[model samples]
Target: VPRDIASRQAKNMCDEGRGVGPAIKERDPNGNERMMRRGVYLDFSEAIGRLGRDAVSARYGNLFEMYQRITGDDPYEVPMRIYPAVHYTMGGLWVDYDLESNVPGLYIAGEANFSDHGANRLGASALMQGLADGYFVLPDTMNDYLADMLRLGKVDPNAPEIAEAKRSVEERVARLMALRGSRSVDDFHMALGRIMWEYCGMERRDAGLRDAIKQIRALKEEFWRDARITGQADELNQALEKAGRLLDFFELAELMCIDALHRRESCGGHFRAESQTPEGEALRHDDEFLYVAAWEWGGENRPPILHKEDLVYKDIELKQRSYK
Candidate 1:
């Protein structure tokens, strides 16, 4: 089954209180991971009993062992609880056919660039694409670009463009450090994460998305004012690093919400709750909504401008994907 459909089902089940356990009783190493230690309990005990523990272990030994360790329950007898979580960032930096971005000399590949997988990624494809880019595609493509740049001959670090970029980063870091407010970096991050997860997660509704956009914008503003980043910018500070990244996440999450809010149809990972069939299947609006949304970040306080690359399939027939 496609994960988008499965995740939606899991979320919908949990929404209806049909979910086996309590919500987010625990978390994983990533910190964002939410576990209902008893998520949706899978009654695989019968399978274990029928197949024999040894037989089951032969195929899923690692999972069985990990599950046992986590819940302290034997898979042979108890139902194994599971929760759907983000394991992949399906889309990343936008890249062309050569895995190069709009910016000259800047190329992205693997899971970093938004390619192969438009929104929902399948198993092994991510690894396959990463390998293809690393071993074949990027090596050849990037070398071609670098061959031209060989003549630029070690540009001065003190050049105006370089100086401006450095100054911009310095100003932002100094601003963050100088804020020294009451709240910790984790505090703002957690708040932002919660808002994103709740409203702009696996499933999204129009109202929820609208509210999320508002909340995110407000959070971004409050973050600038109330965020407390400890230590100096010149040194290696993990907190500072986290704070800076989280600060970027704030902008990205807001844009994500805005994108989700406008897209009236459900497709891949961008499941708009407002647009779905009665059977809970994803709906697509090929006529109006079928286009690539390239969002241009219009500064810190300004609204983003969206440019659409209208999709026109000449040979391939455009059809709604059935995930039934």
Candidate 2:
């Protein structure tokens, strides 16, 4: 999810760099390959709902009654269901106001840096945030960092640590491709997505979440054992590409569940079935649980350390959020 957002933000950055054009082009300052614009943003809820309504009307021949019964409102007079999709991630690597991550040399901008949105992101603000960070924030911040690097001289990429990391990644990729197994990588990925969407989706409960954890563990074990690949590690293999992403998704899914589990109270997107008011709205326990639960990666299937970042409310009063 983080990688997807980063890629999108990078594409948007590249687009903004190249003035108004049919195809975005990036000029490589260094010898490194320039990134390009790519990615499709689809709102599934709207698309699926439209398809469902159309199919139901075509099949049953009673659109009005079905719509009224399902929504308890007139279709012509009311707007359809339009909840926020997974969309873009708001929280990411902790950064200062200057868009510099905790790491000095490495700078994070756009969706990769958690600065703009507090809890819930506002509509149309994503583009604004991305543009602002890339065009305005990163330029100045990166310039400062670069200036410092110039003064200190460029760090050697041949350093033992860097070399070791690269070698490790290469070996991991090679191992994945070398695997002689039955099930395709896509099969494992699709299964993982289905499990995640079913369990850690919009609505969540303790029992369901617990069950999901066990199920995901079993799936991951199956993935490691039964996963297959038909291409060499060095080649441009789409299957291998997807497998890497799926691996990341599997790790991220567990984190999402852990974050959701720790956050007992419902707030914004983090809805808990156990935590709701008598009126059926989200019940926030501000006194006891008013902090963002940030998780640090432990290991494969191991629980992460829960670090709380206190949410201080000043402009917006701490009141019950409602939509009726």
Candidate 3:
């Protein structure tokens, strides 16, 4: 409902100028600063007082294990170091009204497509949309698309283009194996993860995003040059599979920064610090950025080309939202 920007607000609170942590130091009626750490103090001791240890364990079994792992402190004794992180990505492959991607015959559904959530995702609604796609939408839409395909007849497996594509994949895997470097694939992955966490995590600014793009490009170069993987590709090779997945993540991370850099307006999860209000709320430039950004791969080592789909609302009228 709040356009999914609470994570940004949390990061903003920990900024250099306003390192307030989780506490809200609001002035009381008597003019004294009243510190309120909302959701900061999940008092296990209090909860245990109301409901015994067995009840607490039953209620928060997962969190209890997490508390032991993270801090090794009893949940009843100390509050967990709660922090916001990059959890669900509200973006993915672009899809049309029929949930079909630009690529012919390819259909995206649920979390695989970016159609449902937009730049923001609300809790219950997000799940509902995915359910709707699965049960109601995709069935009818896929049938419509498949009906046309039926007329075209069963596809030839030995088609030239299909064989070429298969060969391309084989060549890519062989290349990765042959061009083995000193550093392990895990090392590069960890480095890439750190870079993304530091520069492109919950909070993003222009300088950091720019630096991220540069760093990602450099890391991507080093990744291609110095990634190592053990074992043969034909066998059940987990490392090879991981390395391949990581290859996509590297490119995706770079494109993420590029897209972040391109969109100057602060809206929802894609918050640009330069476009936020003084009070730190995201400032949406609807006039300028009311469109979906789609990026296409433009060959190896080339920047992705962005194509926009204009958003035209038929039911809802545009209005500025404010919450105080």
Candidate 4:
């Protein structure tokens, strides 16, 4: 994911170099050329720019040499190409400000909860956010929840609901193992990845997305029907575990694409081909679309509920982002 972002930034910097001059590209005696690529590095573009021109030049020169040896190309003179690779899921199980999910007993934090970092995330902020939540927010908030639970007395784990849930999980796993299908789990996972990368990748169009949606649905059907597992339910089966996670990823991929499609304007990572400003900057419809979109699960192949949390920007005025 870092490499992908770096490449994209490099490409953008190359573009900037084009506008400014040839100072973006420099060469050593070994014919190994290097160029200062631009994009968000360590999630801070301005800081990277402020690193001093000579420093930037030297750093990128070495990087470009490494990239040339690996890819057999001088990225300094040309754009370093990049496309989105699944890094981390910023959107996931919805949670409240206290990081409590709709399921009363469940509390989600870290990358699992869609707590902070609305729409586009900032670099270095993720670490800060995670630390803040884990070290500070969670401890205080969980104390309150625990206190409330204490007031209500101890809850029994042997309740019918808990037993039923366990039974359902066991049965589901047993059923999956019993299927004895012909295709391996990895086969379906790779197929899902291909479908996701093709349609719901960095760029998106309506027709392509619709086609991708159909393909993903078909793939999901194939996964349930034809996927083969090779281990018992009683033991640790890495294959089975991976299969479950991949299945979840497949479902989540659809939501991501749908969310990206619904968001008409190009902002941060969620870029839509149909929307862009005249200057090629991400055209944010702040007045109409500055809201965090939270999607609720609506079963398989059905559209999810669209919940919006309005964003009120006070310090930073919504402006077209410029790297130049």
Candidate 5:
């Protein structure tokens, strides 16, 4: 089975209240420790017996060691308790053919840019993407922008626009530092993670997504009101950095939910509950949603604007994927 299918199946079992093994405990965003269901079983005992422990150890010695270290379970004798978690970020900031974003002079490359993968990225593709983008694509394309920049002369650091940008950063940092609340940044982060994973993880529905947006907004408000940062802006503060990043994470989470709400069809890793076949297979609607949803941020008060980039295939034809 594909990674997406495996994840969906695991989540399905958990959702249906048939999850096995001891409940794994983790701290939720609300500062409470919750026991999450583990629905997947990874049995290595049969493999260990068939291939011999030495052969299996030779193949996955490091992984086995790491797993044992974390869980204190011996895979050689017992089946490993497992569940799918987030591995890679398939999509990121939108970029053009030259790897340039809408903002001039900013060139995005590798995992930071959304170009190569569509809805889902296969295993080991991130490495291939990083190597291609870093070694080949950005090197050649960045030169085009650099040459243009050279023609325009040097930019002044003391410019009004530059000063305003600097001021904005300082102000934001000051606001973060000024928080005297009892809750740590991690509290808010954990809460936000819970919201996203619950509503927008393996599968999604209209009601859940709408409810998620509201919950996320409420949490974001709570974060702004109560999040505590320990250090000043001038010093190297990991907590402050986390606080800032968590703010962005909140925004990104909302955007993801909004995007999920808009695209009602199940495609790639995004499995909409309302858009599946009788056999529980993902149904892709190629006619209505065969374009890239390039969302433009519409400020704090307004909703985001969706810009569609139609996908055109000349050499290859688009077809529904089957894992039957």
Candidate 6:
């Protein structure tokens, strides 16, 4: 089965209380382990027995060693516990044919640009794209851009816009350091992750997305007002860096929920519960949502504006994909 189908199945198994394991509860990145179900087992005992231990070792010895080091379980003897977690994200900043974003001078390549894969990315394709982008595409396209830059001449570092941008960053750091509240950055981050995982991961719904947005706003307020930073901003401070990243994460997470809510159709990895086929397959509304949603960030106290770039297919025909 595909990773998406398998992941959903695993989630369903756990949700139905049919997941098997030691029922261990450990708290870390996976959220409150006590409240969440343990993962499904990836047993290899049968495989080892069938193929012989020697053959299995030859094929997967290094991977088994890594797994044993992490989980402290010998996969040769026992089943390994596994769960669905975020790995590869299919979409990113929109880019044109030359790999230039809407932002004129800025160019994106590799996984950062959402120009290659349509929705669900095929396995091992990203590596090829990444290679092509670095070794071939950028070398050719960037020359044209750089030639234009030569005509424009050198840019002054002391420009007003640059100073304002620097000031904005400094002010954000100052605000974070000024917080007198007690909660750590990790505390708020874990809470935010839990909310997103529950409401926006794997499956989504209209009501749940709305609720998530509300919860995220409340969390953001609490985070800004209360999240504590342990060290000075000028010196080496991991906590301070984390706090800054978390602030961005809060904004991005809220935006993600909003995007998911508005899209309304199930496409690729984004599976909306309200949009599905009679057989529980993803139901895509190509007519209504056949465009890239490019969101413009509105300033404080303003709503984000949606810019649609319609996808026009010319060379090939569109058809529903079947794995059966």
Give TM per candidate: 0.85, 0.70, 0.77, 0.74, 0.87, 0.84
**Per-residue lDDT tens digits of candidate 6, residues 1-324?**
557777888888977778876665545323446544668998888888799999999999999999999989999899888888976666777778888888897888887777775354556677767787899889999999999888987778999999999999999889888886899999898898978877888989999899999888898898877888898889999988999899789878888898999999988888899998766677889999999887778876466778898889999887765566
Which candidate has the highest TM-score of all?
A: 5
lDDT of 1 by residue, 1-324 (tens): 566676777767775657776555533212355544335766777877798878888998899889899889987677777777766645677788889998987988777776775454666777777888899898899989999989889999889999999999998788877877788889878788778777888888998888888887787788778878888778988878988898789888888988888788888777787788776677898888878887888886899888887777899997777656
* Clashes per model (N, Cα, C within 3 A): 0, 0, 0, 3, 2, 0
Question: Per-candidate RMSD vs. true structure?
Answer: 4.2, 15.0, 8.9, 9.4, 3.1, 3.4
Model number with the top lDDT: 5
Whole-model lDDT, model 1: 0.78
lDDT of 5 by residue, 1-324 (tens): 666777788877875757787777876444577676766687887888789999999999898888899989887777777777976555778898888899997888767777885345665676677788889888899998888878888889999999999999989988888998889998788788888888898889999999999989898898878878897678899999999899889889999999999999998778899998876778989889988899999998689999998988889988777777
What Cα-based lDDT does every candidate model obtain?
A: 0.78, 0.67, 0.76, 0.68, 0.83, 0.82
lDDT of 2 by residue, 1-324 (tens): 333233334444434653222343433312134554433232234643677756645664475567568869655444433222354444666677887765677777666666676354555665677789888878887888777767777669999989999999998888788777899988777677656655676567897787777777777787778889887777789988988888887777777777777778877666677987765566888998887666677775567877777878889888786554
lDDT of 3 by residue, 133-220 (tens): 8999889989988888889987799999899999999998998887578988887777777677666776678898888888777877
lDDT of 3: 0.76
lDDT of 5: 0.83
Which residue runs of candidate 5 sit more than 4 Å off their true CA positions?
15-18, 24-34, 44-76
Report the lDDT of model 5 for residue 165. Answer: 99
RMSD of model 5, in Å? 3.1
Query: Comparing candidate 1 with candidate 5, which one achieves the higher lDDT?
Result: 5
Tell me the spans in candidate 2 whose CA falls farther than 4 Å from its real position. Answer: 1-90, 154-157, 299-301
Question: In candidate 1, which residue pairs get closer than 3 Å at backbone N, Cα or C atoms, i.e. clash?
Answer: none
True-vs-predicted CA distance for residue 123, candidate 6, Å = 5.0
Overlapping backbone residue pairs in candidate 4 total 3
